[model samples]
Target chain A: MNEHVKPVELRKAFRLVNHGPTVLLSARNGSVDNVMAVAWCCGLDIDPPKLTVVVDTIAHTRSLIESSGVFVVQVPTVAQLELTREVGSRTLYKEPDKLRNSGVSICEMAGHDLPFVEGCSAWLACRLISEPHIQDAYDLFIAEVIAAWADDRVFRDGHWHFETAGPEWRSLHHVAGGHFYAIGEAFPADSNGG
Target chain B: MNEHVKPVELRKAFRLVNHGPTVLLSARNGSVDNVMAVAWCCGLDIDPPKLTVVVDTIAHTRSLIESSGVFVVQVPTVAQLELTREVGSRTLYKEPDKLRNSGVSICEMAGHDLPFVEGCSAWLACRLISEPHIQDAYDLFIAEVIAAWADDRVFRDGHWHFETAGPEWRSLHHVAGGHFYAIGEAFPADSNGG
Candidate 1:
């Protein structure tokens, strides 16, 4: 693990994804590790932070999550645009070398035995909270973020410093197809308003 | 309705929120109308487009959604930062004049009876898909977008033109508190890679 990869306080874990960036979902069932890009992830709660991510039935990563009951949601950066597109478009089901073909390098955290992508700005180690109804009906999976980490270079003090970070460090938000927009300028509202 | 407000095809309605921008959710029950800011809305399914939003139990708008069973999810622009913060932080339960105090102007679509917020870039009139389990446990509400519209100036032909649109027209992605990031530069992935 990189020195900058530090554990994010579980309470502030929602901040990792509060901005709504396209995330790379990675999981390991046993010997198999798979990763895929997901744009439907959203923050669900604050304390003991929880989130929801939609995984299609076709995604190989979803099966790993179903079996292992754990997964990692990591935010990819603008520098990984091609990598994000590659992993998102190719399925491990058909392509045996999906991870290698997508140019993804699997890394590990200190305590969790989940697959975390190498260069993402932030990661949330999530334990699947099974809700079969929505999972079967909507393909939406809800999970509690048991542990979280972020590259302190971009996120620290419970906030994202995208304004000061280099352009490549900015998070990617997918619009459609291969089209995406990097998170933009900080616009802070008047403190008195809120 | 502004002449620029045009209908979005149901299949492409997910595009309105695909990039995960903070949205203003409005609901109407009889003569009562309420609008609240939501940072948790996300695209769920494409065909007969569905979405999920987390409205805390304390929100006065949640009751309106419960009674009406329909609400509007509209994308807030960088221009509405203060308005978003106001509605998001203040509740109608305490401040009966929440909408007016937040500087929110309620508008309506031609066919739908739901309340819509003005000066937003896109709007999706949604019919709540009753899911009592998640709603009570997670404060998550699932809805099917029945009617959708976008300001053609910023969104047209099923894509966002944030790179070309004015800075104020860009979608707002909330970080925490009143802090936000407007959608930024277009980062299209290589077609060959995907």
Candidate 2:
């Protein structure tokens, strides 16, 4: 299902990842594009919306993200499980157009250069922030989120509304091996009436 | 529930956090002890199980952790929601025994000086890695996971078993504004059964 991209304020961008959903890292270099699943990622900063994600030095997505200096982190839902596994294991080095081969549809945002997986609940377009030590030592890339968007069905008005959505709309959280857990039940803090 | 504290290979300690559950940061300094909920944390390295967690520099727990060089990250389940909120908001700087005031019980493991939250599904004891730049600039502390434990009811054989447990046993994933989602349903990768 197609969804409109809703703009998220930079300061509140950390909320996009605060819940800790597994994301698909998408990057492109000219005609070549790639997507890979990454469970290791967290919100590093709030004001500028910085995030840190681990990308193995050997992965093809690393070079593409480095060369383009832009990448998208897409928060996928339960319905996209097959696609997540497909893109995660199939390296782009062997098959240049892995997305097409994996049968995962993609749509490129007009303003942002990166393409987002069509079924993801939210997407964040980010520019790499150079930190030589962490990159070399931990295979981690710290980036400033340049633009952010979310599917209104699951997220709206600065909060996630997973309660009203279908099971397929719940975001995925990866555990060890290939196991994943879908997000279930939204309970707002009593302190915040909203 | 009492569970065995197994020593996870330092390299594999990152697996404990791969899924992105909000953790309770527990620290103690002499007679003063504190606990705070943190939604922002990520694995920084695998070999030594280094992790980056944001602890407000001004927080009482930060001072205790910095001085003692030890802290524990407890992955609380949905049943502990009330305790999570209580510990997160009640600062030790004001209420010296916030842990006791919150009505949450803690148990000490042999050979380790730190205490673990009794009801948590998983626990990780860590030692500071001493990254002053990130610690000062972002209030982020990088630490190595020295010990790890999990309640077999929810996690076993190196994977989360949320599908078999009740809602209360599922791990908590904080979305924003005190809203949380319980970890749900498991899907293992067909390619690698593990």
Candidate 3:
């Protein structure tokens, strides 16, 4: 485990993706591991930490997730733009393998072969919650976040400190055609008419 | 109508929220009108423009949506930070009306009185799709975007030209408390390596 990867409380797990950064989805089936970038996902709950991510039926990673019944969602920082876009646009269904040169690495947890992307700020190891109807109909997968981890440098005390993490470490949002916007400066406001 | 607001092609409506900006939700039933902010939402489909936004059972907006069977999701610009936070934190369940003093305004469409945040960049007028189970269990509201609109200055030609929209016009991501990250910059990359 990387020294910066620390366990996050499930109650606070929602914060990892709550700000809506495009994420890299990873899954392993047998000896095969794959990764892809996705922007259509968000935290659905806090207690058990349920997350909803859309996975098209034709996607290879979707097959891997279905067969393995497990997957990981990693929040990549701006520094990983090329790798994120590469993996998202490329497919391994017809190719030999994606892990060999996908510019991402595998992070083993206990005995699990979890796929991870370098320069990412957070990770969510999830299990399928089994809502087959919606999964097939809407390409929407609801999963339970079994374990959560975050880079201590960018995330501490259950909140993101992107303002202090600098631009390279800040999460980025995908805006079509390979373009992205780095999550920018933070400011405070009070909604009490103050 | 604001000159900046114009109809967005229905098939391209997903692009408005595809980058994952926190949105201000507004609805009306009878003489009551309300507005609130939510971060857990995204486009669910493209063709018919389906969107999913989590509406907590306790939120006053949820009742209005249930009763009226319609609502609008407005993408607030960074400039509306204070008003966005105010509407999200305050409750209109007991208050007389938020439209009068919420610092936001009403943007009526044809015969509808949909509350909208001034200076918001995009709007999605929606009708509930009606999923009782998910509504009660997850507070999730899946709706079909019946009409879509965007600030032509920021979004045009089926794409979000946030690059030239400036800071205040760019969308934002909500990060707990009153802090937020205004969407910043745009750079292109290759989608190859397939």
In model 1, the clashing pairs are none
Give the fraction of native contacts in model 3.
0.64
Candidate whose TM-score is highest: 1
**DockQ-derived CAPRI band for the predicted complex in model 3:** medium
Question: Which consecutive 10 residues in model 2 chain A have the weakest lDDT in total?
Answer: A185-194
Prediction 2 global C-alpha lDDT: 0.81
Residues B28-126, candidate 3: write the lDDT tens digits.
Answer: 888778899999988788889898999888888889999999999999887777778778888987676555666777767665567655678998899
Stretches off by above 4 angstroms in model 2 are A1-3, A191-194, B1-12, B191-194
- Per-residue CA lDDT of model 3 for A24-115, tens digit only, reads 99998887888989988887988888989999987899999999899999998877877888788788886666656667767776645677
lDDT order, best first, reads 1, 3, 2
The recovered share of true contacts, given per candidate in order, is 0.75, 0.69, 0.64
Question: Residue B112 in model 2: shift from native, Å?
Answer: 1.1
* lDDT (tens digit, per residue) of candidate 2 on B31-112: 7677889998777677767788888776788998988999999888778888888887888778867888886797888888
| lDDT values, one for every candidate | 0.90, 0.81, 0.82
For model 1, the superposed segments whose C-alpha errors exceed 4 Å read: A189-194, B189-194
